[model samples]
Target: MNGNVTAPLSWVFTLVFVGFYVVAYQHSIHLWRWPYPRYILVALSFGMVLWLLVKMRFHLPWVTYWIEMADYAFLATLMYGYFKIQDKDRRIKDRLFQSANWDALTHVQNYAAYDRAIGYHFSRSLIRHNNLTMAMFDIDHFKCVNDTYGHLAGDEVLKQVSSTVVDVLKAKDEQIVLYRTGGEEFNVIFPGYTVAQAQPLVQEFFDRVKALRIPYNDVELNVTISVGVSSLHRTDHNPLDFYKRVDSHLYRSKKMGRQQITLE
Candidate 1:
């Protein structure tokens, strides 16, 4: 009687342990990309199955076997439920992050994302002495467009201009990112590039915006942009200092002429 009870109990414990091991292995793979863990699990599972086969010669009662199987089924269901909940949680977090950081109208990074990225990059550049450039630009006569063509037209213009700029940056380099910082205003950050290196790209952006002909209703609308470019300065104390300097240069571009690039 003792041997009969012990045999079934041991099998039950082994199955429970295997169930836990499988759940842990799944979690580890989800968190990290590694192959060694998978191989190890396979080897262990094979060994466990062989050991179970050797123990299978014990003629256990049908009721005890059924009970052990039922226990394993319940445990497996719990593990699967937990894994699904974790996956769902991760997806929800990713979706929320995208909605928060991206502009709905232009489908680019929004001002909040700009604020976070600029600060992080600015600090990193100051520490590592890496090249960083910032460019601030806006539609030259954006208000006039909103007044004459209506807000919907203005929105379409913003969308098309942002798309054009994104395409230009993507062609030049993947590291360059554009942000919609304000109404009709956008900013670009060029990582690993100086003002001189970034100049031609900025000029290309200016020319492209100048050439854009957006159709709204029965009329076609033309747009021009004024840009100000600046690089990290030794005198800058914080990201705000860099931002102010670039903003002042943009003001200069607008003051000097409507459609041109200003750099310092």
Candidate 2:
């Protein structure tokens, strides 16, 4: 606190401190957040400049005349290293988050994320006495597509089916979220809609899907889906009890006939 801030020796020590802080800051990945690391780097850079300006007014020893420029070069090198680490960390986190939330094939939320979201919304709906509806659907005779057209074609069909469902239902309510629960099966959750209110929209969505005849490699692959709808009841207590009721209707839809909607 009492050193010659204008002295070249003082500038040398200050720059070294900045360098050490940078090393520690960049490596402290789990500890620091945005702007904290950036602020430290900025303050050090500004101090280096102000100290250099003051040192210019004083005569330096011949041996240390070039030391000021060397300090600047060293600081620049450390900053470059910091930037490299920051960029790498951002990319790694992006990939990790995307893989966790999204399905690789359909680009919709995966089962793990879907489970968490539905459970949270289900609890909130019960507490507020709000309408909560679930619809589960599966492609009718999906195995036939894989057997007849090959697995690659089946994968394409699955992606397109999910895409169509999203485009159709997302506009009805932005809060409505859909997920591919597993192969050939998908689930949609409507937070504030009763089962009856969702019927016409879902019927239209299935009709559009039933009308779809995708062409792949000189083969026209036609597909249809069966949907089962259920609403949350006062008796429901947990996610499993809630989901099983919805799943039962899906089984009924498949049983009555393929390519139909069953809401009981």
Candidate 3:
């Protein structure tokens, strides 16, 4: 505490301490995220500055004054590096969530994400006495498309079908959860709507899908979809059972005929 900060040795010590803080702070990714390392770096950098001030007894010598620039540099570098790292981390997290939640082919929510969202909202709706409807949508004659136009055209049909469904149900209050649940099958969860309320919406969506004119190899393709709707009620059944009921309706729709809506 009694060391003379005006001494040349004090300037050397200040530089050494600042350099150490820079190394430890920048290389601390092994144990900490951005702000944590930034915090430590800042504290250490300030501590070095404080040591210089105290050594000089608060009167900075010419050499010590020049060396104070290192403090500013340290702060700027740490702040910049911190936010840079944080931004990278945030982008990575977003990519991971998208990969997990979104289907690769159709870019809608995958089944895993759909189940989680539906189950969560379904439970909350049951408790709050809100209305919710679930639908299982299947592309009718989809296998025939694959057989007739080849698998690439089939994939295009799937993508167009998904886009059509999304475009038709563009209401904000309609919390729509759509999933390509394997093969040519898709599932939709419509929260804040009853089975009856969702009927016309589902029909319109199916009609629009059937009306799509997708192009492949100089030929325009047509497709149709079958939808099954079921509502969730307080006293009705569990979530899985509710889903199963709609799934059965979906199968029945497919069995009876393509391009139809079956509600149960």
Candidate 4:
């Protein structure tokens, strides 16, 4: 048994070696479809077939069995290492994908994510002939807050506001997506709501924003936001058109007075 035995030196044994991976792939397919009994049967059948081939067909020497056992251990170790490396690569890829879509500061959806969401929703709405509402918002007197409180405080305020808004939106029944489209600006997509239907929810969001106060150092800072809403149009061709329409209402709200909502 301690001797080096090369039993699988022939073409027939090589084919059996290749058949292991083939059966492993079939096992994966069965597992994917939630057929537990079929998968287990296949696994048992594969083991029986391989064992029968090794024992009955290639009955060379007892030392061959021991050597083959060692070979299997080595292959198991190699496969474990390969799977570990693959898992690490997948985790790194996931982190990079998340960072690209999320704001580094506020942990909200960034502009890139916002752009993707717009295109996705636009395509879905165009296909289903559905209505989509967008609300574009900016912090009111944000410069004053930054200049008065300092940059660190500004960051804290942003974190607080974003967290607060996310909490409020999550409590509602309707599906809404939040995005930090600019430094002090955000965009929200309200799926399956018209401009009029989105008003009460948008107002609730503004009220929630007004309710949150951040305590930094000894001072408690208050933050308010101006919002503009627009419904999707049949004439619109692209995501940019939907953004422009909502942004126009936001511009008007900011021009008239800060900390208000305008719907168009």
Candidate 5:
């Protein structure tokens, strides 16, 4: 009975070696979508250790003394380590998705996210005839800042301006859509707000920005922004028309001397 139970050295060696190779290959392919490769490596290492134990049990004379206990300990550690890594990956993925659609510096929705949010809001507000306003804002003489200070300083200025605008807006009942339209330019969509209502908010934003003194290199740098506001009226009017009209107003504000607001 003992002899029957015990496997031959050649059989045990061949089977365990081949099995290890198959598991190793599959494990390698499994790493494609996995967040971390270390867990897989640990699991593979433990598996290889188990195969070594099986070979030891059959081929080595003193296998019964240590191989069985070591195999169990190794398996437990591998499982614990794998689960820890998996949990960490899940948390990181969640946080990434939440922050993905927003700009890091301004904390405003990014351009693509702004488009989607606006489209959804417009569809729902169509039946209600709720007021919608879109405005474009561009910093006055932004290139001068880049020329005088390096791009890093210019970036700091932009961050300051964006933070100022975000702080001035009201976010009580209606959701505000804000985005960086381009370099030194930003776009805002205020749903459930008409031109008249959006005017004061925009004006307040302008005043706040005009008063802002951003610090760079231990010096206070004065900054100002020009704003253009437009309302979405007709159901047939596309979002582009609103953008163009506001852009025109933005240009007009710039041409007429900056630190001003124009509405159309």
Candidate 6:
């Protein structure tokens, strides 16, 4: 009688050990959605078949077989719940990251994102000796618009300008990113592009912004932007110097009169 009880108890203990082993192995591998439902189904079917063979060989009771199956089912349910929670946490992190990095008004990257990207790209460009160009531009007489119309109308103009620039950049190159650095001020980063190559694109942007006619409060308002474009120089020690150079060019454009592109 002891032998009979020991045989069934051993099988029960083995099944429980195997279940935990599989879960631990998957966790060690950092597997996502492991032990999926289909895998669990296959495992359950195989375990049932093996149990049947053992029952025939040892004359084990039906109660032993049912108890082992119940333990396997419980472990599978627990694993499924664990993966579900992980997936939900991943989504929440992604959403929070987006909210922090993107501009709430224009849907483009904000100044904080710009700061991080510029440093990263600048370092990469230095290491790889690749071309990188930056353009800084702002709306001309933007304050006049806000003064004459209203802040609401000024907001609409910003939205329209940002949308137009984003569309243009998307069509031209996927590697280029636009950022709203501040009020009515935007910047673009072009990886692997020289000043000569980026000039036409900047000019196209200038033409597009000049052509924008934003409708607000039953009145149509025309907008113009002054741009300063520059490429990376080997002499430059850091991204700030590169930025200052482009900013000077932009200042020159504004000084020379708005609605033009100044290339450096």
Top candidate by lDDT: 6
Over the stretch 50-100, how does candidate 3's per-residue lDDT look in tens digits? 556554655667676556656756776677778778979999999999999
lDDT of 4 by residue, 161-245 (tens): 8888888788885379789988899999998889998898889889988987789999888889999999999999998998999
Model 2, 29: alpha-carbon shift in Å? Answer: 22
Residues 1-264, model 2: lDDT tens digits: 146677665666667667767765665565456645555565556555545544554655534645765676577667768977998999999999889888999899889888998999889998999998999999999998899889999998998888888988886778888888888889999888999888877887898888888889998888999999999998988988989998999998888886788896
Clashes of 6: 0
Q: Which residue pairs of candidate 1 clash?
A: none
Q: Model-by-model lDDT, in order?
A: 0.85, 0.82, 0.80, 0.81, 0.75, 0.86
Q: Clash number for model 5?
A: 0
Tens-place lDDT digits, model 6, residues 1-264: 234556765666567557756865665467456447655765576667666656666688999988977886788678778977998899899999988899888899999999999999999999999999999999999999999999998999999999999888899998899999999999999999999988888888788888988999799999999999999998989999999999999999999988888888
Deviation (Å) of 133 in candidate 6: 1.3
**What TM-score, over all chains together, does every model reach?**
0.75, 0.74, 0.73, 0.75, 0.64, 0.73
lDDT of 2: 0.82
Q: What lDDT does model 6 reach?
A: 0.86
lDDT of 5 by residue, 155-248 (tens): 8888988887787775433367568867788998888889998888888778988898888897788889889898876743666666788889
Q: Is 2 or 3 the stronger prediction by lDDT?
A: 2
Off by over 4 Å in 1: 1-65
Superposed by TM-score, candidate 1 places the C-alpha of residue 119 at a distance from the truth, in angstroms, of 1.4
Write down the TM-score for model 3. 0.73
- All candidates in order of TM-score, best leading: 4, 1, 2, 3, 6, 5
